[model samples]
Target: MKRSIALLALLLWLSTVALVHAQTLPSVKPEQVGLSSERLGRLVSMLRNDSEKGQIPGAILLVARQGKIALFESVGVLDPKSKAPMTKDAIFRIYSMSKPITSVAIMTLVEDGKIALGDPVAKYIPQVAEMQVGVEKPGADGKPTLELVAPRRPMSLQDLLRHTSGLTYGIFGNTLVKKQYLDAKLFVGDPTNAEFVDRLVKLPLASQPGTMWDYSHSTDVLGRIVEIVTNKSLYEFEKERILDPLGMKDTAFDVTDKAKQARIAEPFPNDVTIGTDTTFFDPRVPQRWQSGGGGMVGTVMDYARFCQMLLNGGTLDGKRILGPKTVAYMTADHLDGSVAPGPLYLPGVGFGFGLGFAVRREAGVANVQGSTGEFNWGGAGGTFFWVDPKEDLFVVYAMQSPKQRVYYRPVLKNMIYSAVVKPNGK
Candidate 1:
């Protein structure tokens, strides 16, 4: 009896050990993956000091490489009033960071033959059918002005993905199209299918489709098209196609559970040189519009899974979401060597709008030292993410505060470069 009892006890011990091992992340050590915990700590300290100095409320960051997650850290209070310190599981308004995820979902549909990239958007969403373009201004004397007319070439799904669909943001500086968008009450409140289509259709194009690269509501329009193509709401399609498949349980368009709301970090305000006084976090409440462009909440781990899937050539844990070629095409710059004028935030950058994020220009220009063929983009808030194929690396950073004041990516790049394995792969 004593011998039997001892054997049972040993079995229990082994089970506990296995449970611990399973719960632990894959063995991607920081040093092995070329990361310095010391540098990471300093980065956290900087964020905390910034919060204490009233620069931001909080921040969260994660670093992963070679199918392993190394660092997941958070700094500052999730809620300043309650003083709840941020945790790894703390939720954040990912903002434009949601774009890439949504884009991935769209591409998954593409892989399934649900839609084609070059197919005219009007083929699915009738709203874009017969879409018009802007031309010359009317004369003050009510006579004909120099009318610049052109064929209304059908805007393709590729155009929507590339922001070449001639759509413009209503909030972007005061312009003629901006005025039209405002007057149409577009992007004013929680957008609906009919309301969004009506307002967007009435607004004239900023430029002819495929003629310019203007950062606009093309993603939101793409979201609507996804609904038409899939016969499911954008929210439903994302849940069915991407989130559930990847075990992204915490990510969603809306906070459905009360417990999740407690974890949802507050969106802090910042100095915005453009648009109205409205900030992302109105004292800890989520925004009304379930905007596809930038309206989802997620944790670092959840987002890392999405990025990891991309880094793994569109498969994670044997679940193939995109073809390897599709992943490569998405990361490759697609702007045909057309340089964006002015001091764009990403210097030496070229546009390659695929499913949702910007593809990197090349191994040259506007890249971190270790960023070889890396593709990345960020949110209006401090949230940023990148996938470095050359290193099989994935990274995500999040913070509350709706302004483009901080340049966190470069700092992160420097930190990453410090940890690159020596020539012999360390």
Candidate 2:
């Protein structure tokens, strides 16, 4: 009788916790969702095996299909040093994954008819009118030096959203202009978004606007723009408009609570430097520069809501953050002729740039398995999420091991697709 009483109490407590997750995906058996429970276990075992082998640190994976969660699990330690068990709510750097959130914020303004995609960015950030394209030519001597030239046309808000603004991340290129980002201190050590943009606006663009797809400070600039237009900080606008509406409780630029800080997933101490995602810059304290391109931290479930919102055509559970048409427009390929097949940042062959995602262009060319209409993005901190509208599926993977980031994204993709017993809502 005592054992039965204890078991009943435990079950009741679990139900209460489930009710607390306002945005939790409904729990459903894999078979009910047309997924093989046994096959899904294969993916879980691999995750455990990888963590046990020290191939990666802590990770959280969530797989939801048809609005029901089929898998959600955490594996490994929160930190190798602490050895505390990982949890589903662990915070992670999220890096470039910030782009999608920032992009969605931009769309919200667009839907309100507050910003026009074609408007010259210089109109708002006037210093941009003074910005010039960095041209390299054999000038005076043969040493390949930078020459300033006027852009064919001023960069517009559209250019910023699709990463065609010609703004280069200093770490990616070796040119003199790339070095300028370093010399200019475009990234803040302790500066406001306005102060950070002061340096960004002064740097010469790497190419003429709309002529190049350089993953860069463009979204960071957009964050500043959000502040200027909404009279709210990017952090504020994102929370009120995106995070809070989506019920992403633990996602933020700063993890204010000391207890939440304890849940931060960290890579091995000896992990190679990952630019701003380096453990050197802590997320516990509030940051002066809120990077829209990267820097936000979140959990697997928090991001799962964001991805599910996109999959559900811009609304979830009565909160309409964006119109279905706007969401569709943003996820469509914007790279048609703007970018060619050279070295690019996409995860696979059949992917192309959208407003804030890598939209899959073909079915068989991707490094992983997915439908052509799927869109996705990843963070330098080994976090990733993808929305497969065709399959009515979305998955989120959060981790902190930069070394295994490259390996696990495809691994999760392959495993998730293989475990699906039904496709295209059949």
Identify the runs in model 2 with alpha carbons over 4 angstroms from their true place. 1-21, 139-141, 275-280
How well does each candidate superpose onto the true structure, as a TM-score?
0.85, 0.93
* CA lDDT of each prediction against the hidden true structure: 0.70, 0.85
**Residue 85 lDDT (model 2):** 96
Q: Highest TM-score among the candidates is held by which one?
A: 2
| Most lDDT-accurate candidate | 2
| lDDT per residue as tens, model 2, 84-191 | 999877888888889999999998999888999998998789999999999888867778889899999999999999888878787654778888876676654777
The clash count of every prediction, one per candidate, is 2, 0
| Worst-scoring 10-residue span by lDDT in model 2 | 272-281
Candidate 2 residue 340 Cα shift, in angstroms, is 3.6
> Tens-digit lDDT track for model 1 on 271-347?
43335433563314444455677677788778888888888888766667789998887776555544233212232
Name the regions of candidate 1 deviating beyond 4 angstroms: 1-28, 136-152, 269-274, 281-289, 338-352, 367-370, 404-406, 421-426
The stretch of ten residues in a row with the least summed lDDT in candidate 1 is 339-348
